[model samples]
Target: MLPNLDDIAPNMAGLTIFSILHAAPGFSQIPTQDESKLRTMFIAPFGRSCYAHVPVGICLGPEYFQTKMTECLKGREGCEAVMITQSSTKRH
Candidate 1:
């Protein structure tokens, strides 16, 4: 069982935020104000990239979510999963 609204914690000051986009069919979830700020951190034209952490609530879930994702990533259906990430760093 996932945590409910009442279980949500306050956004700690200076903490970074990330968004997940798998719940909505065919489209991503709306970005919160924090996400907008993070987007601004990207320097475009020259180059732009996101060194972000995936939202925990969105990533960690019941078996249903993880199972499908794991199978889908391991070449289960002619699909490939590739993530380009660097050494994890503290965000804020």
Candidate 2:
């Protein structure tokens, strides 16, 4: 089930290649005000004026919810994930 990453590293060639979903872009590698890639790539998915294709990208697994966006996010925030269900209840 996963595709090989061609034109890439040999060791990683056979492994599954997927996208990362980051919120707030975590500990800055470079200041975002200067238009750092860490800031741009994560924010890219939501905008129309800017040309980022992440909105239309594939839903490959391992949705990593970095420490900055734990409680507000699903998928165990950054740990393991289990299938859960919510059932409707009749109000008294």
Candidate 3:
């Protein structure tokens, strides 16, 4: 089950902060054994180039990232409470 922010600190003794992660930054943290799998040619105004990290447009990018993050948070209490689809947080 997911946590509802409305239920958090109903007495106003706590705080909630919202964070949004852009796909590119997270994807860069994941290394590919064969970088060629992540490669894609593109032509921008500056020039033509390819991505060194996983591209945001890839169909599996978001799911793959989410799985990795879930693995990282596995066994931690309140992990599921803080996870909202593509975004996740670890209390520290």
Ten residues in sequence with the least summed lDDT for candidate 2: 83-92
* Tens-place lDDT digits, model 3, residues 1-92: 55466875463344354554444478887765465653666889999877766777778889988898778778874554342332224552
Q: Taking the tens digit of each residue's C-alpha lDDT, what string does model 2 give over 1-92? A: 33335633454433443444443433332122334323335434665342232222223211422333455455543443322222322220
lDDT against the true structure, per candidate, is 0.42, 0.34, 0.63
lDDT of 2: 0.34
Task: Sort every candidate by TM-score, greatest first.
Answer: 3, 1, 2
Better of 1 and 3 by lDDT: 3
Model 3 ranges off by over 4 Å: 1-24, 32-39, 80-92
Off by over 4 Å in 1: 11-14, 23-68, 71-92
User: For every model in order, what is the number of clashing pairs?
Assistant: 0, 0, 0
Which stretches in model 2 have alpha-carbon errors above 4 Å?
1-48, 51-65, 72-78, 89-92
Q: Which candidate is the best by TM-score?
A: 3
Residue 26 lDDT, candidate 3, scale 0-100: 82
Model 3, residue 76: distance off in Å is: 1.9
Model 3, residue 7: what's the lDDT? 77
Model 1, position 42: C-alpha lDDT score: 55
